[model samples]
Structures are given as structure tokens and as C-alpha cells.
Target: MPRLIAPGSLRRIGTFFSDSGYTREALRDTLELSELPWRKLRNLHFLLHKTQEATALHQLARIFYLGQPADEALLRQCIPGAIFGLMQDAEMLEVKGGVAKPACMVAPLENLVLVSDQITNMEVELLPDLVLLPNPTTLTVSRFMLRKRGANVFDLGTGCGPLALLLAGSAKHVLGTDINPRAIEFARFNAALNGIENVDFEVGDALAPAEGRQFDLIVANPPFFVSAERQFVFCDSPLELDGFSRMLAREAPKYLLEGGFFQMMCEWVEVKGQRWQDRLDEWFTGNGCDVFVIKGFEFGAAKYAHERLFEANPLHPERDIEIFEQRLAYYRERNVTAVHGGLMAMRRKAGSNWVRIEDIPHPPKECFGDDVVARFAGQDLAAWATDEQLLDWKPALTSRVRLRQELTARDGGWQPTMQRIDLVEGLASSLALEPPVASVVCRLDGSRSVREQAAALAAEAGADAGVAQAEVLRLVRRLGSGGFLELPATG
Candidate 1:
């Protein structure tokens, strides 16, 4: 068991990864494979075709990212001499039979250097059961997570501590908790590897690790896989379908400060007889938190079970399909209809709270956390606004918003058809627009108050000013809530 990860060694290795331009795109080009081929080929594909003329990046990539072995001469050529010595001293290098093997996987994810279990590290006896690695779920939460300066943060079920390390750059303090002790150790080692000091890792159950304490921000990507049995500690949950996600959503509010935020990527069940929105709303019962949920892809029970079962036992040549069948049986017995995946954002309020459930099909080009926070603030402002008060304010279209009207061949001529408006950058929200209403929105250039613009639009449409003012007021609230328009600054 190689345990020690010296800080000096990490810094030198981190520099090498940086100078080598080690990115997903780089690897894709080097491997000469697209997404499908990459999935089919894994790391073994690289070793099976290694050439004598492999570059330094290629050798290092295979050794560090793919858990392959390289000769001492090749490692020395790829890495600086001092850094190579430091790696050997820190137990990252296992020398045997004139070949050096990497003990862990160190790769670049965005700007952070993450350390996790190698994809095919055959020294399974030394590693713990089902240790997690940096996966798409972690990347999803990381991209959407809010960063608050000088605030206390907790990462519930932190696997490799990537979220915590990223937050430590902005947060005053961070605590990462996991039930698996090996995960805690890897997280701690990664913190040192990245030279991040404001974060700490500990072994404890979800939310139990931070009991009797309140934080300004908390983010979690818990073990939400609903399973018939807890075969893997990293992904499986002992609770029923969506039981773990519901438990955290229900309990995390009590551990947050007033006006604080708790964000987590989660999956919930869509029961056969119940609406998914209503079932998810039940999770926030008795809460003082305003909830925003953005739903993503959904899967059926049998398909989900088969996919998970296949992922769990990837190295095994022979698999018992009966295990997947057994998991599907549980779902059938519980009358489960489908499984829905999404990310949820909760802001702790004083008393009154609201919930928004949406499926934004478009992906946001910018970070999502800022857009969520802005919408919540806009919602609060709208909740207290009188119709008269709302009419007095000037509103501008968001820079990220755009209007599109589909073209239809009517009478053998291409003409305008249905009009739609959507956000182009931050958060993906779209709404259909009547041509008349769309015309009115176009006139809103922030040059005048809503009262003035609506009156102008009314005159153009031959409608009464007072009547149109009320209608435009509703649009103002809708656009503001959807992050399509920027609201006026409130006192």
C-alpha cells in the first residue's frame, strides 16, 4: 500500500502535466479516436499499439493516466530527474523488474490536478472496495456549484475531494466527508498534491460529519444509485429508489445558515402514478429553502440496472445477468416508472420559500451557479412587487438572451412561423412568444420604464394603455424569473 504523497513531489509532477498540455482534447488527438472508439478502447488500446517513437507526453500519459508501466530510462526521459526522484520517494513509483508503475492516476481536469485510483490498477488487493474516481457527475456539480468568498463550505460524500479543492480557492474553509476511509485518504492526498491547505477530509456518514454546525454553503454529489443491494460503497445506496437524495434534500436545510446555499447533483424516481415534480417537491417538505431543479436525462429501471451492473463489473469477462434482473425486480415490486437525473439548488431563506422544477434541454455556455443565484434574487424581488410597483421599473434584455422565429413554407414562400425566445449563454431556459408579444418585447431597450413601453405597445396594437400595462407587467415578471431579462436594482 503506497500511502505517502509528498507536497514537493506533487508540485513538480503538476508542472509536468501543465507543460505537457495534458487535456482531454490532447489525449483524444494523440489516441486518434473519437468518443465511441475511446469508450470501446480504454487504456489497453494505447498499450497494445505503443510505438518505439512515442513522445514524452505519450509515455507519461500511459504511465500516469492509464496505469501502465515504463522503463526507468523512459520515465527519466519523460520527467525531470529531480521530479523523478521525488516521485519514487513519495511512493508514486513502484519499481519492479526494471519497469516503474504508477500507483495512482494523476490527471488534469480543467485547471485542477486530481489524484484518484487508476482505471486498471491490478494491485486491487492494496486498494479498498469500490473507491470512486473523477467522473461526469463530479464534473457536473463542479461546473454548476456556487463559489462564495469567506464562507464555510462542506462537501458531503466527497470522493476524491475535487469539489472541495476547487472551493478552497474561494471559500474561507472547507470540510470534505466520506463514509469510505480510503476515499478520505485519497482526498487528503489530493489536497496536498494540489498544494491546497484550506480544505480538510474526514471519514463520516453523509451530513453526520458536520452535525451541530451550520455552513454558509454545502455541495454534495452523494451515492444516489438506487440498488437492490449495496454492492459498491462509492455509488450504491442502501436506501430505496431516490431515498438518499430525498433524505439529504430534507435534512440539509437545517444545517445551513439563513440565506445560505446547498447545491447537489441528484437522481429521483418518477413514480408510475405520481407527477415527478410533485414527488420531488415532497423532498423539500417543511423547509425554509427556495429550491431550483433542472432535470436532465431519464432512464427506465431495467436499463438503469443493467447499465450500472455492467459498469460495476467491467473487468470481469463473465457476468451474471441475473443480478441485473434481480435489481429490476425490486423496481417492479415498488411500482417504479422511471429514473430522472438532475441537479438541485437550495437557498435557505428566513421563512417563505418557493420551488421551480424545469427541464432545460439546452446547455449553458457559462457557469450555471451565478445564473441560479441571480434568478432566486429576482424571484424574491418579484414576490413582493405590486402591479403598480412593477410597472414603474425599467427592464433590459439579458445580453445572453436571443429571439428566434422558425421559418415555414406557406403558399410556396418561406415566411415567419412560430416565435420563441431563449437564453443563449448562462442558464438554458426557453419560452414560446406570440408575435405581438414578441414585437412588444423587442421595443423594450431599457430606454424607458415599463409604464411607457407598454403604453407605446398598446397604441401600436390598438389596445387600451391600462389593459396592456397589466399584461406587460406579467411578461416582465416571467422574463425576470427566467433570467431572460435583467431586473432593475431594488432599494
Candidate 2:
């Protein structure tokens, strides 16, 4: 069981960490911690080699991040007496033999600091209900999900509740749910530690706690790993391979308000004799939400097992061989060919729905929340609007759009050989355009309607107006779907 900290003590601890410069900026800039690898043992040596003096920030990093014990007298000299007492009383520090070690880890995430149970070391025994801090997937989902303000928001499988706390800043009310009681305790403790009061954490299975309640936005970082056993509460699920993610896709839509959004960080298996997209899209066949699956990477069965089995202790490959073989056998029995990982986003609507599966190839570098909203609106326009309706609508390119050309030396001056337009934001998509398509795009200034532009281009080329209009509509739909062009408002 985790010890609960009083609200007052939590506030004091937060103040102490902030005032001591235990921040992302100081860690990255002053300590140069970003230059080192993330392993625990390596980080300790790196810090020792980088700085000789043990400042308050150094002491905090050693205890919390590097997983090293610090002298009790040294900690007393740096931390405030009252706050130190609060930390000891709350069981955040384990002191013995004149040395103190952190019972939990506190690290800066973006602008906020979060606390979670100490990360699992590969050589150490794994705990069943270990709470995890923000990882790469958490950061990816946080950057990709929609961040629009709403009256209510829901976070499923909230773990230590970082996502729920982030949503609280923009939402009127936020609720986070998890199945592990230990995780819920940590979530509640973190909520108090961060001084965020608008969020609530509950212990419940899957989406049970938020059932029958409509939300403006729903985000989940659930235990969607396709593993053989329920080894870890933070990553593994009780359901068989990939069933948990499929279950969430089918059930979560019922809890969303009309026009609400649901985004989840997930992984799905690509079985033999089946298209992965077709298999996953079947989950939302008649469901009332337009779905988008942004693929990250795919791994074969053997590589997938090795990656996941060695996740905790990558340094000891010899120890993981037995476990890896067992997991690989499990996959072989199920005909699993490959495993895919990515983000799945859905928007609730009341008509025929469309599902788009796009491969991103690389992870996103920055937040694309606004780009997601734009793509949703753009797809809606493309799917429902007729050719005539599209011509009447005025669409304009976003300011982030830039055109690039490749020039080669010809007989005289440089001549353009290849041309492409790039959308610098969101997914950073770059598409090659033909000369005719390039000419069509340049005319989109939002001042002239599509019909007028199509007629003018037809007159310039002596082509049939109807044929030109058809070509223009195709270009608009393609660009709009990619979030390159902004379309007029739809009713």
C-alpha cells in the first residue's frame, strides 16, 4: 500500500522541488542530463563526471532520478526542515544507516512535475502493481490528442493520473479511472501533489466508472499491450492478445457525446491471412464515429517478443531468452505475423462514418492538436460534400504551407525539374505536385469561390468548364483531407 500525503504536505513538497531548481530546464541546461543515456546506473556516473559540487538540485536528482542513496545529513542541509519532516512522515523517504533513498521518483514533465513509484530495475524483481511515470508513448499521445476546452473529459486506465491532471487544466471537470487500487492511490496522491482540484480518480475496471456519462473529450493510455500474461498492471491486460484495445474501440463510443472525440494510445496484432487495417476497422464498422489510425511502427513476431521481453533489463540478454521463447511460442500458436503500434482517434457523429488508416512512418515532433481538429473537419467536408457543393465553398491554404522546387542547370539558366508542397506543421507531410495541380493550388486565395477559379482555369487552357471543375474538386478534397487547405464552415 502507498502512504497518502496530506494536502498541505503535498503543496509544501511541490514548492520545495520548484524552489530548489529541480526542473526540466535546470536538468537539461545546467546539469546537461539530456546528453546522457536514460539507464539508471549510467545516469549516476554521468552526473558524477559532470558536476563535483553536490547542490540541492544534484542531491534531488541523485535520490529520485539516478536511484542513489544520499547522506541524511547532506539532505538535511539542503531541504527545508518542515518539508523534510513532511516527506519523512509521508514515507517518501527511507532513511537508515545515515543514508536516505527516495521511496518514489519525481521528474519534471513539460511544465509540471509528477511523482510515481520508483521505476523497475531489470535485475530487481518486478512488482505486479507498479505505477509508471510519463514514458515515450505518454508523451506521444499527449502531443497528438485534441486539447480543445470542454465541459467534461475522461481518462481511462489513468495509471498515475498524469493525463487526467493535464486535461484538468482545460476542462471544467475531469475523471480518471483505473482497476488497480494501488495505482488509484498514487493518482490521488499525485493530484494533490500537483495542486489540481478539478480532477477525480476512481478505482474501476476499464470504462465502468465513466459509463453512462457523456464527455466532450476522452483520452486513454490503457494497458493495450498484446502479451501472454497479466504480468504488469501498467502495461499488460487480462484479456487475450489485442482484445482489450478492440473492446475499448467498440465500447468507448457509447460514452461519448455527439461530436465528442476519443483518442487512445494502443497496439494491435497483425494476424496471418488478414489485412491489419481491415481487421481493426471491423471494430467500428457501424459505430457512429469517424476513425483515424496513425500508425507508428510494425514489428515481426520474433522482434516484437525480444523488444518487449527485454524492455526492463536490456543490459542482460542472457536472462531474457527463456521468457522470450515462451512469448514467441504463444504468438506462433495464435498465428500472429506482426505487431503494430500507434494512436487511434475517433469522433462521434450521427451518420455514415469513414475510417482512415494512415502510416506516419516517424513519430511527431510537436503537438498537433489543432491539426487533428482541422483534419477531422476536412475529412467531414470531403466525404459528404458533392462536386457542386464543393465548388460553392471557398477554401484557402494555411499559412504553414510552403512550396519547394528542384532546379537543374539546363542549356542556359536553371530550369525547374521537380516541385513539391510541404505542410510544415502537424505530420510534416510533403507531396509532389504536377504543373497543372500546382497552378490550381496557387489560385486558392479564399477570396474567389472554387467555381470562379475553375472557370478561369478552363478559359486559360480552352478546356471544358465541367471537366475543369471536376479536376478542381479532386484537388480540394485531397488537400483538405491532408489539412493543407482550410474549408468554409459546414452546418
Candidate 3:
């Protein structure tokens, strides 16, 4: 007999998740169920959406406190058409029983996974490499490109077409390309399932050009693992070591529009004698674009080799000493003592290109990719002082303004001095004597030149005139670059 749902139990479940940081709104939106069943309230709501099966069999296993029901036969019977109907309605469902299925399935933008969808002649199991589910960082990067640029975006090596579908709403046209035909089919089926128009899926290698087409945004989360051998279908690329990065650097520019951005995650080998930043900077060569590379994570050679090899065959009993030694030697020969992974954002510019390489040594485990977008959108130093436009102009001070200096040690133990021209709040202020070097700043009054101010300050403080002059000029330049100060007009 089918177990009856308990009264008020589901509400309690919802309340529990809400208190635990999950939202009631997310459940309603993903499940497409107006209300959750009271009996299944205690069940993990995320797993229900993650599993993608209508009956929530795994969820029910715990809810009923059943010790692993022999097989899914009973669960299927109870749920009947729930998985299918849910997939039909929700558009993405996680089916638990499939052997090759990802450990967790996801429908981007929507949090639900179809855990149990019935498919004949296929064993249900989890893909070993599919440990972590796709999170908001992956989705946000894709969604931002789609929404911001819209017309013509490419989801290169589209695994499940999460980014491609997200692009459908914003982009005038979208293409989801994958090397695997199965992935292509899945992408197409997903597009159709969602009733999404203008998104086309194609089975093609990213290395190959897509028939004379260009995109405003080209996004890829390529298989960046450095492995001795390719094993997993989804995670391993045909290109080894730095192959994916090389391919992206070489090919992505051809497909991008001027000012278009190519955003991706990559793992690069850090070779000796060559700075990792320099190695990554070379990837932007040939492409007339500005590149921003953020090193998000790092792994030693041993750890990297083990992760890739383990995935290839988890049951490999023989720990071959020779094989392990050779792997370490290979990395050492290339001066690659470690593997560093990070987010790379490239913009195709019109003129003299620039590459900004930064080491984000510490990045949050979740959603570090968003930082790439933020940095790309951050204030441009050049734009701050372009001659075409100028910020607010203040009247030249006629009377000499009293300047006072106060130094304080911050939490980081760096001593920074605050230079204030007046006591007025929000007025121009400067930070001086901060570590790595000494500096000074003040408002430029048209009445007195920067040279005059430096001379006055030096005389007042009984300091070297030359030292004071250099410090004042450095501060003025920095302030001008930051849009806080501008060259005073000559009357």
C-alpha cells in the first residue's frame, strides 16, 4: 500500500530548510509544485530537486526509514508518471538509476535536478568525476554574458547546455557545440523540452571553426585536467596539459567580436624560470585584446597526478612506483612543480592590447569566477583621466588651506598617514606613508602649483625638498588616475 503523507509535515520540512539557509521560494520554483507534501517534509529538499526523479525515491528511502529498497521497482510504481511529468514541466530532471549519470544533475538558473527518469536498456549509476554539481558561479558567468551582450553567444563544449539555455532569453541567437554527439542530443532535447527557441545544438570540436560565424561572447569551461591519460568523457580533453589553454588562446579570438569578452576557467602548469603570470600572458598573444587572468587555486604535481589518475581508474590496485616517478619527472622537466588554476577574461580591443595578470592567491571555494567579471567591469584607470571628459572641477583655493597629517596603523600592520586639507567631511583627503613606500597627496589649487605645495610642506616639516617634491608628484598622479584630482586650468 502507498504510504499516506503526514499532515503539516511538509510545512515543517520547508520551515527547516528555510532556517538552514534554503529558501521556500526556491523549492516552489524548482519543483513546480504549488505545495510540498507534508509527509516528505523532513526529506532534503535540495536532493529532491537534485535527483530529478518524480518520486524522490532516494528521498523516500530516508523518509520511510527503509534500509535500501532492493531495487527501484517499488519506487517507480509509486511515483508512476511523476518523474516524466516533473521533467516535462520542470524541463530538467535528475534520474538516479543511470550508471553514466552525473553525481548531481542541474538545470541552470533553476536549482532542480532530475534524479530518476525512466530509460529502457540503460543502467543508472554516477559518473566518478561528477562530484561537485554546477553552482551559481558557473551559471552567473554564462547568464551575465547572455543578458549583457545578447546577440550571438557560443557555449563551447556545452556539456549539459546550461549556459546555452540561459542565453536563449537574452541572445538573439545561441549555439551550443559539443564534441560528443550524445551531449549534442542532450542539449537539443533540453532546448526542446524548455520550449526555447533560437538556440541550436551542434556536434563539433571546439578546435574546428564553426562555418564562418562570430560571437559577441564565447564562454567555455573546458576540460583543464592535466592527466597522464584521458578517461572520463566529460572532464578529459583531447588536448593534454596546456592544450585547452593554448587552443582557447589561439582560436577564441577569431570568433569574438571587437570588444567582445572570452571568459573561461583554465589550469596551467607553472614552469620554473617562467613566472606563471608570464606563461598565462602569452596565451593572449595574436589576439588584439585586453586579458585579465586571476590565479584562483594551486596544486602540487603529486596531487594533480593522483586526481587525474584516480579518476581514470578508481580500482587500480597497483601503485606503480616507476609510473609515479616518471609523472613527477615530466612535470619537473618542464619546470612545472605545481599546477595553478584560475579564471581568465579576455576582451578583443581595437588598438594596442594589454594584459593584466593578477595572482588571486586566496579565492573562495564557491563562485570565484564572479570576481573576473567584477574586475573586468571595475573602474578603468585610463578612462578616469581621458581628456574627452573630466570630473567635477573645484574652484582654485585663494587662501592657503591648513594641511595636517595623522598616521595610524591598520589591521594589516601597514602604517598609513591621513593628509587632510581641511576639516570638511567628504573633502579630498589622501593616504600617505603606506608600506612598500612613502607618498603624499593634496588638492591641486590653481593658485599654487604642485611644486610650490611640495616646497612649502618640505620647509614646514624641515624635510628634504627633493624627497617631498617626488612624493607630492606621485600622489597627484595617483589621485588624478583615480578621478579624485585634475589639472587646474590656467587663467
Q: Pick by lDDT: which candidate is best?
A: 2
RMSD, each candidate, Å? Answer: 2.9, 2.5, 10.9
lDDT of candidate 1 over 1-491, digit per residue (tens):
23656666676766767677766556556654222213344645545364234566777677776666778777677777887777777677788878998877766666776777775542233233555557778878887888888889999988888889889989999999999887888888778777788998999988888889999999999888877776667777748778988999999989999888899988888778888778887888677788888887688887778777744455452554767677778889998878888889898887678887778644463467777787776776566678888778888887877898899999989888888898877778887887767887877778888898888879889988888887788888888778777764321
- Stretches of model 1 off by over 4 angstroms after superposition: 28-43, 46-55, 121-128, 315-320, 411-415, 488-491
Query: Which lDDT tens digits does candidate 2 get at residues 1-491?
Result: 23677887787787788888888778778888663334544555777565445577888877776556788998888777898888888788888999998888777766567788776443465677778877777888888877767558899988888788887887899999989887788888878877889999999998889767988888998887788778788898569998888888988988998988899988899889999887787888877899878888899999988788755334566768777888888999999999998888899989899987777877566787777777777888778888878888888888878999999999999988899888876676666777666887887888888898888878887889888888788888888887788754321
C-alpha TM-score for every candidate: 0.91, 0.93, 0.61
Candidate 2: residue 423 Cα off by (Å)? 1.1
Per residue, candidate 3 scores C-alpha lDDT tens digits across 1-491 of: 11112213322322332232232244335444333222224543543444344344333322221111223454444443543333223333234563112222322244212111121101123343332223334543443342544568888877657777766776888888877666665565555444566888888888464658777878887777776556555666567678876789767877888877777777888777777677766777767777776666788888777655544444433655555666777677666878888767787777766565555544443333333443343323333333212222221332323455676878877554664543122222222334222322333555566667667668866779888666655554444422243333110
Pairs in clash, predicted candidate 2: none
Best-to-worst TM-score order: 2, 1, 3
- Model 2 compared with the native: what TM-score? 0.93
lDDT of each: 0.76, 0.80, 0.52
Candidate 2 global lDDT: 0.80
Candidate 3 overall Cα lDDT vs. reference? Answer: 0.52
